[model samples]
Target: MTKNNLVFETLPLYNKQSLEELLKNRINQLGDFSFEDDKWYYSKKNDNPLRKEDFIVNFYQVPIQYKNELKYYALLSTGLPRVIRTKCNKISQFLKFIDKTYLELTIAEITRSHVNAYEYQLRLKNSATYVKQGYYAAIQDFFMKLTDFDDTPNTVPTKNINPFRYIKEKSKRKPIPKKVIRSWDRVMKDQDIPIPLEFRTFYWLIRSFPNRISELLSMRRDCLKSFYSEYLIQIPTTKQSGGFIQEEIKTIPVAYSGHGKYVINLIQQLQEQTEELLLKNNIEEDIRTDFLFIVQQWGFKNNGDKPSVRYYDQIFHLKKHKINALFKQLAEILDFRDDLNQLIIPTSHQFRHNAVTDRAYAVGYTMEQIRRLTGHKNEVMPKHYTHQLIEKHKEIHLGIENLRSSNVSPVEFRGKIMNLDERTTKQLSRDPRRYLTWEANGKKGVGICSDITGCNPKGTSVHFECYACDWFVPKLEYLKDYKAEYEYWMDVVDRTSGDTKRAAHFENAIRNVSYLERILKICKNGIEHFKEEKLQEQLDKFNTPPVWE
Candidate 1:
């Protein structure tokens, strides 16, 4: 019989107990085997001279060729427990298939033909891709170790060679629909996704800093620094191919988005609130170094002084579970589909997509600018979110004057007009106090300040609420005809402005409003004429002012 030459974590089954115990147990138990550690080994009980071959059968000898197979399997199994278990079960089944022929055959007899036959057998019961790929993966570690062991001069399995490729499964690509892309932003805005601040910061940081989730989660609080009058966050060290890379980069600027200021304000608010809460509970603020998300635990010792904040690991494993739950909730609220199980959730990762779409692509940032911000380095921009592919094509100036009619009064306008979506309008309605201040420019001194400020030139039309030049004027003189209204506004502008620039600004605004009013009148007449029967109903529903008004 072949001598056992493999290492085991525990004593070999054949050497673990007396042979008499194994033979007695075997004879008394109908030739069934009993393993010591629920594995592939047992000793038959017998003190009597037993054949060496029978002992070999009972020993379940680990062949020298397969010596490092289990170890390699274990090495590959780290950090991917699910895949390891799946591969282990599949490999066990395949081993049973090979056992029928090999019994004790030398490892050299294994060939491509034998593997191909096994592949055919697998195809009969499973997908070709699954059988060929899954089985190959299951046996890859064994072959890799076999070849490595064979290279060593002292190794017994010198002739054994590996026979597996390093390639993996290929998948087809599909373009993401614009509807789905837009839905992501809408869903986030409308839903109540209560992600903890640490997770929320990490989520945005991952996409904004373009940091990996694992690396971000593993970071220490000491890695962050807040400098006076600085709008940038400096991360000291980040994981890379060559260990930690030392570099300083501005993450998100506080200039345009206002998110950076908001975050700082929010953190200060949280700190103040937490300290107040602690004081009320008679706890020290010094004991608040725990994860930002954790709440303190309170218990009674009959004297009412048992409040404590328990230390918890910051690398909470709730990301997948929480994201999936939010996706389910959002899908239900949006009436997206009856069964969410069939679709992937619009998760926090999709926020990365939104940033790319809205900020990088839609807002006219160059590809190079996007790459710098996204940290894509040299990788090609994904076709799913390239500006050319993602942006909706439009001739900006063709209907530039249409915007004025978008907010016309109920009586003056009768047609359907395109207004900004709720999210866009809400963002545009922010106070312009911080960015710029406006001054009136009209003959009667009648003007109103713009409600917001920002400048992203969308072709000829730029949405900016310049506080220094904001002014309001009444609608056209005649709702049906605007020649008189245009003349009146032109005269008003000519009489009041101190310079051509101011006069031109007032004239341009009045002309825009006049064109928009005419366009809206045409739209209203069309709607009233086309659908005369439902016109009154539509008007009553949409145009009716509030009861309080």
Candidate 2:
């Protein structure tokens, strides 16, 4: 009767063969029908067979109604092969779940209830929080694409349908402890363990430079540039924007000294070895020009007539999982353990975290400075990496408070035992300068003046030369504040950029803080004997009072 009715009438009778043909025709139209030539090609004897057919089959098994939807999605994601493959797998899994549960694979059958059920099932299977969240997001993206497609009939509403809409995924990755890093470094340097050259170089490079694994693995031969005696490396960061993989190149200095090993030298050696291997195997000109890192494959042959010639066609590159596994293997070999004797397996990302955290705490690098090294788009990420350091600093603050309370004694001025009254104690608590008392003629006294000129005499913004002045008196009760100020000024000096005047100011402040801290420590250590002598001297001063001024 009608065109829509006619299509709906024949939809139930469609079989698998016709569906396969339809998918094939659609894929051919999209210019992806190279199944025969695109199949796995083994360049060497031990190379793993490519499994493209399995992906192809998964793509075809997607319902006929959703075929064009997948194509549209592919068009939107043009060059990301890895993303396309992963999304396709996620969609295929959802389709299969629908087929087994509802006896139909059409997208129209998907509803909010079905999504909730799927999520519940995933949780029941003990899937990771991120895994469940990723699947939910992928499915939501798929349905959103289908809703926007021109040819597809509206089966399910895309808006406000995500089952995990409010769910948040906490990152499970933790920073590796500094002790573990030291242990790993020690194990790598030990000659008896037979560590691979590439692994050792990679560990140092990643730890020192803070580059991502992908950036390091994809480095080219010409990435390094020399400026006189110093070398700099241009690292391309692709994941900063969180969208399409776009390269944002960042230049980092190659340290020649204080790094224990020469990074630039090791890189040059690796490049030379790669070139020699490429020449020996006669690799293709394009590959030789493109890639830098390459490994020679070695294994036993049946005849054993000298090991098979190393081939450039089968160049080896370490994947993310492989790098992680290698770290785990190294951890096991080194017998690295935590305080509880739990084995500590470090991840590749931990090196980047360690680099950021250690720089933030130990080297006093500012967030902006760390951003330059880490290729972070903003200060937020660098601050997040330093969360542990912030916590540690808080603990130090608590310890400082305890140290001040336990160390400081009561005040003694000149030859008089200054008794603590509520008002005087409140004044001292409000401003530490209240403890400084100047006696003009042994009886007439004035309180809290670093100089004879009194406070803020010069109308300056800061207290100039107060801590270093001879008339200045630092109460041991405020020693913690002075120590904290000292640390802050030191950090300021370290982070000051190219401004000699400002750096000098911070350095001077640090010196003053240090002087005050040393004085307070000396007074605190001998407060008991000083208090007894002051009490005896006060009795003598009372017996011989000075004339009134």
Best by TM-score: 2
Q: Please state every model's RMSD to the true fold in angstroms.
A: 31.5, 25.5
lDDT for model 2 comes to: 0.49
Those runs of model 2 whose alpha carbons end farther than 4 Å from true positions after fitting are 1-57, 78-140, 143-149, 152-156, 165-171, 186-196, 227-230, 236-242, 245-250, 255-261, 282-289, 297-315, 318-345, 359-549
Alpha carbon lDDT of each predicted model: 0.35, 0.49
How many clashes in each candidate? Answer: 15, 0
Model 2 quality (TM-score): 0.45
lDDT of 2 by residue, 1-549 (tens): 112122221222233234334434444433344433332111221112343332332356565555555654543432234455567667767766766777744565566667666777777877666676677777766664333233433343232444444567677867777777777777655656555556666776776655678777667767787644346665655542222223445455433443422567677777787777767775543343455566553222222321122223465654556678767655655567877788998888888767544432222233445466568876443445444333433333223223223243333344222333453344333223223543311321223333211221111112332332333444444445555655765465445322322322332333434444544554465466567877999998888867883
lDDT of 1 by residue, 293-361 (tens): 222332112222211122332322223344445445444444442233345345554544444333321
- Runs of candidate 1 exceeding 4 Å displacement: 1-68, 76-79, 106-117, 123-126, 151-223, 226-258, 261-318, 327-345, 360-549
Which residue pairs overlap in candidate 2's backbone? Answer: none
Alpha-carbon shift of residue 181 in model 2 (angstroms): 1.6
| Clash number for candidate 1 | 15
TM-score of each: 0.35, 0.45
Error of 1 at 549 (Å): 99
